[model samples]
Target: MKVASFLEDVKFNSNKPSVLMLMDTDFSKELRVVFKKGQIMEDHQAPFAIVVQVIKGAIDFGANEELIQLNDGDLVSLKPHIVHNLSAAEDSVVRLTLSKADSLQRVKNV
Candidate 1:
């Protein structure tokens, strides 16, 4: 197993999102994305499943046209092909855990 350390502060540029690949293998990719205040990931869906965890600050989630607010320590999963989106509020850092479609669906249902 690989051991990783916790992240401290991160910075993002204007009109661009900051992305960090915390872990990546042939089967999956784990990322830590930082969105500045008022940053939005835009409205879209992914081909695979993704899990979002609010590490710090706050985030607004939009899925199926429904809005959900997430704070520190909160976690959420996105189903494949589901319409979903994310936005940051006042300097937020979100951890995105992405995995294979089949594996994610099985995990989600279990």
Candidate 2:
């Protein structure tokens, strides 16, 4: 079995959000994203469905121009190719889980 703490051992970047790849396998890919207050992850899209969970703090999540506020313990799912963006209202940690697909696609900025 494998285990990890998303809240521990986090790495931060001054120019961009910090990303940590927690797992990457045939079945799924898991990542941890850390954003400082006011940081924004510009709109992007993925080729496979994904689940995003807020682990700490808050964020404004936008999908296809629809905005929603997410706080710790809140989760949302996005289907393939849906345009999305994230802005941290405060320093935050988010976990992203991507399901298996023919190939993992990089987040394409919109």
TM-score of each model, in listed order: 0.81, 0.89
lDDT of 1 by residue, 27-72 (tens): 7766777778898877767677788898888999889879999999
lDDT of each candidate versus the true structure: 0.73, 0.83
lDDT score for residue 71 of model 2: 100
Task: Judging by TM-score against the true structure, name the best candidate.
Answer: 2
Tell me the TM-score of model 1: 0.81
lDDT value, residue 90 of candidate 1: 70
Question: Which segments of model 2 are wrong by more than 4 Å?
Answer: 102-110
